[model samples]
Target chain A: MKLSIKTIIPIIVILTACTDDIINNDASPSNIFRSFWEIMDERYVFFEEKGVNWDSIYFDYQPVFDTVRSNSAMIKAFDSILSHINDKHLSIVSNDGHYAGMFLNDTLHYSISFGKVYSTYDFSNLQTYSHLHLAQLPEGISYIRILPGLKKINVNDLNIRQYDYSNGLIIDLRDCTGGYMSGYNFCSIFLQDERVVFYKQTKAGKGHNDFSGLIPLKIKGENIIKKETPLIVLINRNTYSMGNGIASILKENTNAFLIGETTGGGGGSVMSVLLPAGWSLTFTQSKHYNLARKLIENGINPDIENIPLIDFWKEEHLDTGKDPQIEIAISILQTTK
Target chain B: MKITLFLILIYLGGSTLLVAQEEETKSRGTLHNFRFGIGPIAYKNYYSIPNGLAGGSMSFTYQMEKEHKTKKRDFLLRANFDYSYLENSKVLTTSEPLFRRFKIRLGPGLLWPLNLKNNQLHLQAGGNISFYGEYIYPTESGGKHIYHPIPYGNWSINCNALIVARYQAGRITIEESLKVAIFTAGFFPEFQYTPTSIDNSYYWDFLKINTISTIPNYRMIENKIAIYFPLANNQTAISWRISYNHYNFENSQKYIEHNLGVGIRF
Candidate 1:
């Protein structure tokens, strides 16, 4: 094809005419605040459920942000803005350290500490994996304690057949914060059948309510634990994310009874992104729902609620046989047997 | 850095020697050139890494040109790959994020000689339709099975305006080419998400067609300068090239690369 210089010159001119610079080059307070707000507005998944008025937040914070000068002030302003949302999955990290929502600052109370239980309990044939502890309590009851940040749990290592669950089995998930969703596989050993445990939906667009179709999350039952075996799951406000998910699964699918306080709600899938101002922001990217089609973001409720008297975080309470939750669990298992 | 400087100095010295030698011209029916390059690259993806990653890039290109009395028609195919390492920090530990990129471009163009007074100066103007694809991923630390590497990809059919200028100095030919994307129909993810599975459904969701123009949504410009010296047999020639490329997608994701290469034309 032959083209004249005149035609080519005009084409080039027209092409160059449609340009916009979207990148914020300056780190001014207003720019930083705008970037943070805009990023959350575009990516955060819980505005509708959390009842966050994002446009109103922008209007309110734009004035506050304009007055901010230092990075510390900026962080404080950001924290203030995030405080309006109740999502525990949301956090911002900078050189100043990690800043999270109000839920994180609320001092969650957990019933039992695995460290104390290991030091205090009379257990036999103990097995420890990364983030998992398996042992046997008295009366032929099996005890499994799951810790936070559970990445991988090999069912083979648990030696499912070696232990006896004739009396009952206790799965302790207290204070277990979020980890890989695959960590829910720990429940596969007790699953009675292949079942859809929950559903998840991710943000699909810029709109607040824009979400993808629900993707059912299924877990196959390994039948390692027989249907007649008694299973008890322990949960508290500290049990979150995958921990919350496991508790819900055990309650709905298996005959496992839940004991302890309502779980710390962190049902959403968390993802982190780097902001233009060098701060990293983490927020929920997907919403998780239980089999009942209810949002698990607030947490899953236990069958029998028990609040701990001793502070689990305090070392003085460590290894004390005074944990009422464990005693109640033992009593319940004995009664069931 | 020192080796790069030394090689550049040698290239300049060789070019000067060729410029001082006798001037010559050759007419050929078809010419093929193959090039290989490696150089340091600075990269960043706003969706993945916060800081700019320092890395190296390697590229290979093959070109075939059909020469006529007044014009040259050329077909070009090129591929470039990059690997960058993130610096360890408080947030990112042991298994730090590593950025990797691969790009492929193919196009055919027509070039017509421009009327100029100086015999040494040869200029041509035309455009080409290029098919371009790029895949970029910043690997996150964790068990590979658990943590999905979020990928940034661009697949576009673009119309590129091309400008080529050649100057004959002694027995060496100094050539410069400029190509700029004028219009693009492309696919880029509006938001970053880890695909639930490596399936066609995820690809369909991620690869929605988004038309972008040079003015606002997307922009790409590539410039290359090469010096060619004919071999003793006159059937083949050795060349050195330096090129710079800049790309902006949706004004949010940006990429810049520089390359120094050695080539042979037959």
Candidate 2:
């Protein structure tokens, strides 16, 4: 009935020991690698589409991970294994900085510089708003350049009514890396009727092929721009993800003509998971497809493939005459009139 | 020097008066105490964060005790609410996220005296039906703008067993209490297939994915030790408490917390 400090200390120690079985805190390289592999196997949605043999990946990388003694070595080993799947959305970020699966080294070859486009053209009423750059090109053409992300914007404040697009409108989406799917809002501005732009499916279970039913991505008809107006979308290999997606939607649903090289494909929605080693891994968790049920992960082809000859990186090459994509769009609009 | 002497005299007189008042009210029928505490807390919730989070916790507790003729037949009721703001231990950058936790508990029990030797040492066994709910979520927007932050939470009704011991040495009382959840019925979320978002029926989805858990999958333990020192007024006491809690569910999610706080009981 009497309890002493000695009795209490021992009882506390015993109870603490009993609770130790609850969590596993193993931080060994092999355990971390297994955890990483298991998470990818369960959550990653592109395994079958990318033709990734996940089991083979584990078989090849497990031994290397087991022998790695340092964090840097483990990261390097992860980078080597992850490179097999060429998904730019997939990346590993640790204290050492971010390591991406794929880098767009040839972006300059396919895209024109936004700075050059801004400076070269005698654009009137130039205004850089949130997520949008508005300017007036010659012959009553409206030039609207979309920025990276599709953060919510006040459509009314955009003063879009002030622009006269009787000749045409150009939606420049070059080098628009990616952002939220809310970019659909920008696409809806020119839509004449409600249209299904794409279909998307997210993971439903742990299995690689487990996915929810395809949900149609739809944009409502705002008809801010007249349906009769000629719309031209400029894109290049540097336009990716939502940028590429918006281009495809506008090209397929609207009377718009896409003029540029093929878009950089990144159709998946990405999600991140924190690993036990203090590193975070981001990968695609959803798949996107065009209205025809064809996968859009490989990039969308333009209606008229026009690659500019001018070196976009050079300030001296910033000339409207040298930008064949823009020149062709202007000529087409002139002929239509 | 004269003013200092006068102050010392007044302090001694007040202490004598407080002691006299304490003796007069030695046998009271019912007692009520309110305690508010704030202290550092070390926390980890494996469901949301992999590493430990360091933060501060604030708690408010109200207790009512009904005294009886026999020491064994004492009735007690307690209710507590606690809030904690815990951040990742890593140096926070713009990308790093912060998390917060909320908890509330209510319990009613009877204490039975195990030993009443010398009236200075008291040991008691207590049993309570306790209801507890805890929720943890990110305080900031998550890593990238694309991903939605998922929150982890659980609620449980438990049969709690407590062993409480108190020793009085002069003007200080030292108390140690160990509480263990002997039986628990817990509700926890199943493994999520996708992150929750506004576009989906996330609330309904969460309801459909909930699972009931029992002792085999849920376990909880808490131990607290406190030292109380009576103030000059004798009606109020200041105490310092240190508590440790461990909760595990489904063998996959674990939460641990350590708290050190100072409070006033009146």
True contacts kept of 1: 0.06
DockQ scores of the candidates: 0.14, 0.12
Candidate 1 chain B, poorest ten consecutive residues by summed lDDT? B140-149
Write model 1 residue lDDT over B1-103, tens digit each, in one string: 5644564565455445534544444564677877777765555555554334445677788777777765354444443333334322333323344556777
lDDT of 1 at A152: 49
Best by TM-score: 1
In candidate 1, the residue pairs with backbone N, CA or C atoms under 3 Å apart (3 or more residues apart, or in different chains) clash, namely A18-B215, A18-B216, A19-B215
Off by over 4 Å in 1: A1-25, A96-100, A107-112, A152-158, A192-195, A220-223, A310-316, A319-321, B1-77, B85-169, B177-187, B190-192, B196-221, B230-252, B260-266
lDDT of 2 by residue, B1-266 (tens): 24223423433333333323221113336667677767555555443444444566778878787767665366879898889886433322334445678888898987777855446556778888888887877665444421333467767778888887665555655556777777776566543334432133344554442444455445566766666667764435433334455555431455444444455555
Query: How good is model 1 by TM-score?
Result: 0.74
Please give the TM-score of chain B in predicted model 1: 0.77
lDDT of 2 by residue, A194-279 (tens): 76778888866678777788877677667788888899998888888878888878877879999888888888777565554445
C-alpha-based local distance difference test score of model 2: 0.66
Local error of candidate 1 at residue A252 (angstroms): 2.7
